[model samples]
Target chain A: MSQLDQSGAVPAAAENAAPAVSLSGERVLRVIVPLVMLAALVGLWAWYVQAYNIPKYILPSPALVAQSLVNDWPILGAALLVTLKITFAALAIALVGGVVLAVLLVQSKWIELAISPYMVILQVTPIVAIAPLILIYAPSTQVALLVCAWIVAFFPVLSNTTQGLKSTDHNLLNLFELYGASPLQTLFLLKLPAALPYFLAGLRIAGGLALIAAVVAEFAAGSAGAGSGLAFRLLESQYRLNIPRLFAALLLLCATGVAIYGATSLISHLMLRRWHESAIRREN
Target chain B: MSSAVSMNAVAPSGKPIVRLEHVSKTFSNGTIALKDMSLTIGEGEFVSLLGPSGCGKSTALRIMAGLGDASTGRVEWPTMPHDASGKPEREIGFVFQEPTLMPWATVYKNVWLPLRLHGVSKAAARERVMSALEMVGLDKFADSYPRELSGGMKMRVSIARALVTRPRVLLMDEPFAALDEITRQKLNDDLLRLWEQFGWTVVFVTHSVFESVYLSSRIVVMAARPGRVIDEMEVDAPHPRGVAFRTSLEYGEFCRRASQSLLSAIGANDHL
Candidate 1:
């Protein structure tokens, strides 16, 4: 029997009035409200700079920050590229390593028990404390930053994917058993596909975390040779008392974080749109 | 009726198809699912294991299919012309209560499962798959996914999958229990037609008294709590049973008698 009601309009009406009430409208509000708030904050800053007649060194105006961004475009852009390179490299490593660890964890209980405690310890430990030690032990600062970021991003994917792989439907599992499918066949066909939603969710979270870890690690472990990332630029600008340049660098970092979140979410949506409820919710 | 036909009676080609002797199953959880169950389904007999929920009817079917172990029994079968004696026979096909069609696979591929498992080439199995789909009247919907179909259509695909293997015996576990009254009756008729067409013996498990009465040549009534067969009834109704047969006075009387027997087998405490 069909579960669809006679009046198709009723479900739609309920959906509109209930949880999705503000969801779509709130997305527009989210963008509009934040932009309005940013404008007001900038307006207040500009007024304060002129009213109090504060020096540019103390608190630069938004215009001054824009000018500083233009003036140091070449150097700052290079540093931005460096940070992006490290972030992406670390993310790639984390993705591969995390999935392998998750697969191992699923395959053997002993390995999961032995390694899980260390993974937790790695996650909880501060990056600042480990960066210098990694820098000293590792050959280069770039490698050290990559390792730190990998450590930060690895756990979420590993934990999420492991749980997803194990969360297959019992009825479906019995069906597979009835067919006389081998363990490996079941894992590849059923477990892997079932785990995809969770893995994508974890990847989205890890994308932002990986970027944060890259920046944080650079702050602790000094940048070598070609002048490191946005974090180094931030610290240098602060030391030089270049307020406008510091604000511009901070803006870039925030933009990078937002981009990572948006891009990963898009990837997740594209991959899961056909079968998953999460993607279906977004469709309406 | 007193002819004393050989328990291992040879088919027209001189071969006994399936034999089960003293089959019983006790789950590791200590539930006695079946007790001293023995039945030899001939070439094309439609035998229904009519029982209540916990009567081990399904368990008995599974044991015949080799999907589960009989804690204490032996099942023997003559090696078909295509099979070697050294190799285990894989001719039995099973249809579960829930249409266990693969959600990911299309109807065509789902029906092709048994053949694929035996390493049969897809190209060679294509005709057989289509024929099986045709039998279920679902050949047109072969490319459709299980989720795209109705409950009745999905169950039809499940039956098609079982039939595709050209299995000698079909073991069904309440295959029509999930469908509506109309759909269930239609499927029951369709199932018997398939059984007759292929000349395949069916060991059907069902809770419905009317269903067993309508489709079975012989009905084995079972009782729960260490489930065992309590009574056996042989329906003398002729083959090619039509829709009108279900509404006939004889069919209703048979159903009533079967229901009474089932109620008594369930014990005096339980109400229908």
Candidate 2:
């Protein structure tokens, strides 16, 4: 029943300073174990490729895919740029549309009530089912792809920001009233700042969704005309029985997703690092 | 009963700064927050509404501050002689229980809120903001955000924001109730100093019997259920009440009398 030391440090004067080294050693083990496990998986994949005599079309080796990615760099790089453009265009439209919708909804409860059910329907309905219909009616494949992605990514921002705007504290509202602040002032100063954390969270979620939506829409629409992207390249590689090329296109897509996530989280951190609880340091 | 001199004495002749005549408030949900209450606060009197919770003290203060309209009575203010249009009066400042600061705003910007709302340019409002911050002893922290400050400091910023308008009357609803004892005591002293220096009427609401005795020249005890004023006590102690006076027997006697009146009000409220 001795009192445990709560300083979160080992006594430097004690012989048990060895525990600090042991703790850091445990941290190293924690990192190394995961790396070793990943290495084992890679070794097993290589071994299986050699032992099973699987055809390249059936299952290409990671090294072969990497090689093919380098070999077909010009085509894949063009596809990557096209895919990035679609993703960013769709995201920009979604951001603007979602924020406008959120402001409309917050300003008028009747509008929110009338529009929310349809917004939910759009959110829940499959984008794949809608993409072909959009392609036919949209006049342009690029517009169709952008619309599909915007539909997919816009709801989270709208819903999150709406909730955030509505979640301003009652006391704060009273303070605004006491100061004779107009509705616009209250919205800009109090509601918008209060809603920022929620909006950033929604943006992070929407960023990844926008990338997925762009890829999914391209997959469904067959990338006809000048709207070709990574998904079109994936389909093209598959049709040609170029498994390595397909894998390469997929790697690009995965990298895009990861990059979108990383960039959004960085932006969220940068914008919120000052005043938000989500970004505040917990320790003194 | 209808003598002119007595009626004039009852209702100060120097153009009432704020007059609540038979004011009543009843929520739509059938809760009567305030019963018919009549009160007039003079030009520079420091009055405290002393009551327990649910007594509608805050409601009363809000009515005076023009945040809420009384359901059954008229609130009147004397037309300022200097006003050209002879329209409704302006310049009332309100401080709530919570600091209610904009977290994203620096202290200087927070204090500038009222003036900014009134369409005062930043350059024009800068001096007033600085003076208000200086009055609250927060001149050094004007650039700091509310989140970076302690609770007491945040409340100081709230006070500074309220004072930046230089309102003729200051309505405070338990602004120091959330602070620690030491901070609360210090603020009470500082508030009186500011009140004396500005010569502005203060209609403060508080639950603390001791605070009402120490800070207010006049205490109005209120009861709930149908919130109404039960008694009014006058503290004839001189201004610039020091720390020594707080520890003095006279302070204790004043607190006891105020507490007795407050308890009786609460007791009367309980019977309802």
Candidate 3:
């Protein structure tokens, strides 16, 4: 009687453990749902423009925007290349600078106390507010725009990496000490590896911010030439009242931002999939 | 109290590995973690610093490991080889209460850490790392990360990491305290086996009386509230202690006496 009761009790938990939906079905729903929503939104937009017979200058139709994108490909494409160059250059510099600064700051309390306040001051002040000063001092408009993007993107990396360095496991530190590890060894082998997840997290956030800052700084600089970025084309298109070209440029910027985010997320996932909680897949 | 029970055989017959003489540690905030705690761990001895929480047993173990220094008195390692800097070489390995494995690293890499720090190349240290993992029965899980393993397996990885250096002195601060009873017992047996095979002088810090009795040839019972040693007792039972020893009448008697000592140590703090 007791054995039968025990056997009967096991099935409730077993039933609860079973997943409600198949894994593949759930995965298919995730991808399909978003594409469906996007299609519906685009269809509504196209219908609304057609019904109103809106002027191209006021609000370009999806077909007109697509046509403009094809017609203005040379100009807009070159501008995109310029903007991407500035964004990536600034981000690379920021990664190196932020990580080095964080490592130096963590080395001594006094160094951190003296320097961290300045970093905070820089972070809190608006980038546009400082863009004019940067433009005046910089040798070229490209350098000025790069500086602005770097200033915006670097703070998160510095702060997050600093936090990661400081939060290293105390026992592990002691273990390193017990092993008679040198300071450089501790920094590279212990602290750096421990701080990787935080650095990657900061990088993901900074990726989007870098692109935004690059465009905003260009808007502030308002420098117009063949070497000008997408921001300049947007301004030029607006001034000419070529709203279709402006919409096409705007669409390109949105795609670039999404691409940057997706790339950063993929990097973070690939780096951390083996160990980090956020990246690892759970059984259920 | 009985013929089998010996009074304070604190120092074993072998040469001393490390000695803490009148060591006391007070933090900057003025809390005395340890007070006048003097103990000597001889070579090839398994000594458990048995006490309740806040008793400075872990503090004492840390001092022994040279992770922290005593505010007063001194810790001496008389027999160990010294490095070029006139300090003792990395002759000691420590296992913390937690597994403390590098989460990002594979089991093979985590176990490889101590040797890597000592400037040993991967190719050179590979054999020893594998052997250490084999000792802990986790050789098959070498490529797995700490997150992938069970609690016991992670602890085993930690043990393997500590052993990779092949240190003469092994210091553990309640290393198995978080494990389930079955896992803990299994680890206890594995640890004893390693100690016997390696002849390592182990200073194990634990709060459990039963655990202290089971593992240690000598048990140092300590009191908290300023953290001082109150009693020392030796378990005269023979080694290769396993399930039969765990359930034996002799083991029960040792546990009973150790429990009494621990209770009175706690009782003494209550009186204060």
Candidate 4:
């Protein structure tokens, strides 16, 4: 969602000076259907709870969930910060590691052949299977959690960026050669800029993955005392049978994921808006 | 310098800019792109390599630019100067079939690329960059991206970029083939004027007889299926070939003869 929206809205949007008054029926339907569905879902949930006289332990009412969110603000907020920090740090580390590895990989065919199989093995191997191993090796639980998150978040970035780098226009490569451009000049001026869209796309995928990885790792770590993240909070709420608080924490995580998507999309828009076709708005 | 080209060395300078001596290129997969080709380009000559697709017109041009290796023979640059590195330094500009502009860069930056690679700072290259754009009549669009320009405008930027280095030899591979007829004609006239102004040797690759006759002082007609040159013609027409010359009797005569040569070149394939 972040990649698509940014690619569309970043570039050529300034040319759209006129405010469109005649919204098409399809566009209207797109907005109306999802919103109507959400309202119906919440209404059904409320009605079902009241009509069945369901207890709060099994499933909290929508109103009760909202009340829990407001009431448990301080605890949830701290947990949200911890989760967000781990997620963002892992994402940052993945970005640098992935792009650097991609650049080094593309420098030689031998290097790529030697390294790619291991990367594939890493990608295919489940992170859950490795989380306990990482916990066993690392001195701190935080480091172990970060390692799992980093492993999960790094591949999409490396692969997409490598594909982008390799796909540099053949004609443009010829052009660079014709101009007698040095290899370094070609890499920076041509290959890197060409890889921007792919990198940002990778960033978008990695953003959501970073969040999920952090949570999963936190679950495996199972830190119960203080300084725990939202995932641990979620496990604690479940063990205590605090269903409403669990739902509230789950709600916060979902909202955080959406926020991550929104942030990546905005960055893509700002960076690619000037010239990329994906960011351009054509007159239909 | 003679790494791949066959040894047929001779470089007598006065009139000729470069000599192609029995050059042939056959790909590793056994596809012959150019075979036993030979041609001599004179200084300040507006020469067109005119033939159909796969005729080695482009392959011949690439050999002259030293962009491709000729498996059979040599390309002798009569006037190429030797640098301190003991290699003949090349000062050549090549334009491709497409505009091939970097979409991310502004038109000014696109024109400035060659100079930038040559270690000229942007501030130092500003005048030259603007002048190249001015030659193509796109100075006003210096700051605009390639996508924002019309097709013709983008090609003009491509031309500006090629000309930015003030190369002694300009090689183009059907640079205007994708444009509409009107834009093609306009660019053809503009190109001729630039040739006259720059005093550079031009080896233009095109299939259009009218374009070749209108622009060239000489046309080298090529045949395909093991691409090789089969015919050559000297167009007695002068520079400043305009709307009047395009419709004139002599222009038609050159076009007619050129067309006949082209047909025979294509006809060579029918025999096979």
Top-scoring candidate (TM-score): 3
* Candidate 2 lDDT by residue in tens digits, A81-137: 888988899888888888888988999999999999999999999999999899999
Who is ahead in DockQ, 2 or 4? Answer: 4
Q: Write model 4 residue lDDT over B90-177, tens digit each, in one string.
A: 4788898899988889999989999998899999999999998888887877998887777777888898898888888889999999
How accurate locally is residue A76 in candidate 2, as Cα lDDT from 0 to 100? 92
Best to worst by DockQ, what's the order?
A: 4, 3, 2, 1
Q: Candidate 4 chain A, which ten residues in sequence have the lowest lDDT sum?
A: A1-10
lDDT of 2 by residue, B86-123 (tens): 32334777888999887767889889988988789889
> Compared with the true structure, what per-residue lDDT tens digits does model 1 show for residues A30-50?
799989999999999999999
lDDT per residue as tens, model 4, A1-284: 01221232335444454334343655787789989999999999999999999999999999999999999888888899888888999999999999999999988999999999999899889888889999999898888888889999999999999998998999899888766778999999999999998999999999999999999999888976667899988988999999999999999999999999989988987888889877765222
DockQ, each predicted model = 0.17, 0.22, 0.38, 0.39
In the range B1-272, model 1's lDDT, one tens digit per residue, is: 11112322222222446666777789999999887766666677788898888888988877666566789987776664333322235566778889976665688878887777667778889999999888888887777766557788888888888888777878889999988897887788888777767788788999999999999887878888777777777777877897778889989988987898798778832653
Task: Score chain B of each candidate by TM-score.
Answer: 0.88, 0.91, 0.94, 0.91
**Model 2 compared with the native: what TM-score?**
0.88
Model 3's chain B yields a TM-score of 0.94
- Candidate 3 C-alpha error for residue A227, in Å: 1.1
Off by over 4 Å in 4: A1-40, A281-284, B1-14, B82-90
RMSD of 3: 4.8
Tell me how far the alpha carbon of residue A146 in candidate 2 is from the true structure, in angstroms, after superposition: 1.0
lDDT of each: 0.80, 0.83, 0.88, 0.84
Predicted structure 4: lDDT: 0.84
Cand. 4 TM to true fold:
0.90
